[model samples]
Target: MNDELRLKIEEYLGGIMSTSEATLFEQEMARNSELKEEVILQKQINHHLRDDKLNAEIPENEYTRRIRTYVKSDEAAHIKQVLKGVEKDYKERVKKPRRKNLMVAAILIGALLLSGIGYWYTSQATPQELYASYYSTNDLPSVIQRGDKDSKLAKGAVAFQENNFELALNYFSEYIESTSELDPFVYIYIGVINMEQGNIASANMALDNAIDSNTLDSSRGLWFKALTYLKAGDTENAGLFLKKLVESTTNFNYSKAKDLLEKL
Candidate 1:
């Protein structure tokens, strides 16, 4: 590409182009396949360079110099050609309006780049980072009125929703000890609380009890167990549980487990 076209692509990718300019540029890209490919290449290159960990590992000037050199190499040319093919196939298979097509084109290129870089990203991520990314209490059972507000179960559930894990644990423990026929979900609450507190062994034991309960929600424990292992950086064990989760479409977080399995 000529220097002026390259500069324009950079400006567009950089979001420095004004509204009218961006609109015109998109129109230009629609008519010019080569411009679209160049834009995709630049976006991917920018993404790699902007990665925090990558920037930390390599000196700024040196990394930029190396990346610029690679961008001008035969390997990058081959990649652009491959991207061109991907765009062509994607366009042929899916029909959408012009603006939506442009958006999908960007997304498709991003997905392609992610596929290539996913392993590197996953490997570099700390176990804690992965856990933080996936672990959420929002989906957990919420407080329900069990007729008596003073009941241990009600108290525990309320505390859990309030983020008072310590209080919740105590209430949950009391509830478990008070009954022979325990609700399997009580064990899940305890497991999640323990896991949040970094009590991995206690968390695993509680989760195991939930799983072994064989209730309708037993599969819920499996998902947490996978996450427990993931939080511990035990990818092998995590993958095993994640695989089990994906076996049934009805399993809790089946699609999410499948996606997480790919990362593992």
Candidate 2:
């Protein structure tokens, strides 16, 4: 408010005031606290306004104009300096978008890798191929042993699968030559294979061998014999063999035989 006090405050702020000015200001502060308070406020305003990073966005020309305004009005400088923090120079905040982009790209790549591996696994394995890879599905090993392709019994099974009755009969007959141990089911399978190839008479003969095993025929073997008879259009013989399975208390195949008989 006074010329002397204003000049004294300016000199003190510029670091050119005498040491006596500090003592005088302390005494003056007790007498006129308002002026001392105003001087203290001016110093705080000058500190923040002088900081460049605090107002990085103030254009060069505008900053020079603001500096001139501050040199003239201490009170206006305080208001403008406080506003410096309000318009924060936020170039560092731009990095947030880049971080989000990287995160999305990482997720996309992970999903693609998982999908590719899944597709590759399925493409290399088919259901039938998986089945053929195994030697057996039931508890028994394969009917044909490893590297037993030359065996007559093995040949019969292959020919039967191919629906070649004439060739299957020859191989099966040869298998029977050394095997009193052969299960009657083997004969029943040959008969069924024969019927599939349209050899009704040979099918009947093969099935006859299954039923006349002379020893205890498997209820399963007898069931297949009945099935063979049904295929040959001899329902009477089919029903007879089927009754064997139906009547056997311990026959696991009895349920299937009864189901088949009901359908017949």
Candidate 3:
């Protein structure tokens, strides 16, 4: 591709294009298969570059193995040659006034080559793997001792902790039906139980209730909702909720949500 076209592709993928510009670009891509291919290639390159800093720490042999496994096209060979040239230029220009740009270019090219492996691995991760990696019940509130021990909420909490999801759901349902003043946390518990049972639609409904509760811990619902989508392999929807969680520093699991968003 020409340098101008390449730059435009980069800008488009970087989300720097205005809506009208992006629409025009999409129209152009639809009419030009080569342009569309270039755009896809640029997206792959950007995906690999997103975690460049982390890829820098990988051992060279392991990195090379990964690259060999995932990248076999002539384009990859061209990228290798370009990276070598950038490295050579960087070494030769280390003491010059233009060293900064050379350094950045070298790093970018090196990362482009190395990080494809990481990107491939990330892309290969199953939705179940992602869910298992991020999901945990440890942070859930302990409701066993709250209020009366004989209360339905307390029984539900105990059942949930014991992995008796069916019993927990029953007790939680009873608790909800008995009260005009709903405990938002109970909805969260219901959501978690339903999610564990693979009832995605029901889980989402309960989570929605928790969010609409407008209570202090309402943000917790966002995190669980993201996990629900992740478990269901609906990463696009998962990202929506994760983005909401990361918008406020005080939001539950804000840092984790931010990290997960990057992975997605």
Best by lDDT: 3
- Give each prediction's root-mean-square deviation over alpha carbons: 21.5, 36.2, 21.1
Across residues 1-264, which tens digit of lDDT does each residue of candidate 2 receive?
Answer: 878877777777778867887878768877887986777776766767787345333335887997877777977777577467445533343446686556555654654454445334422433223223321213122447633888887787677667676787788777788677755656766766665555766766676675566545555456555655665556555555655566545653677666554444
List the candidates' TM-scores in order: 0.52, 0.39, 0.53
Q: Kindly report which residue stretches of model 1 are placed more than 4 angstroms away from their true locations once superposed.
A: 1-124, 143-147
Candidate 2 TM-score, C-alpha based: 0.39
Question: What is the per-residue lDDT of model 1 for residues 77-107, given as tens digits with 9 covering 90 to 100?
Answer: 9989979987986777575457756665575
Collision pairs in model 1: none
The lDDT, on a scale of 0 to 1, for candidate 3 is 0.81
TM for candidate 1 is 0.52
Cα RMSD (Å) between model 2 and the true structure? Answer: 36.2
Off by over 4 Å in 2: 1-142, 145-147, 178-185, 198-201, 214-217
Q: Give the higher-TM-score candidate: 1 or 2.
A: 1
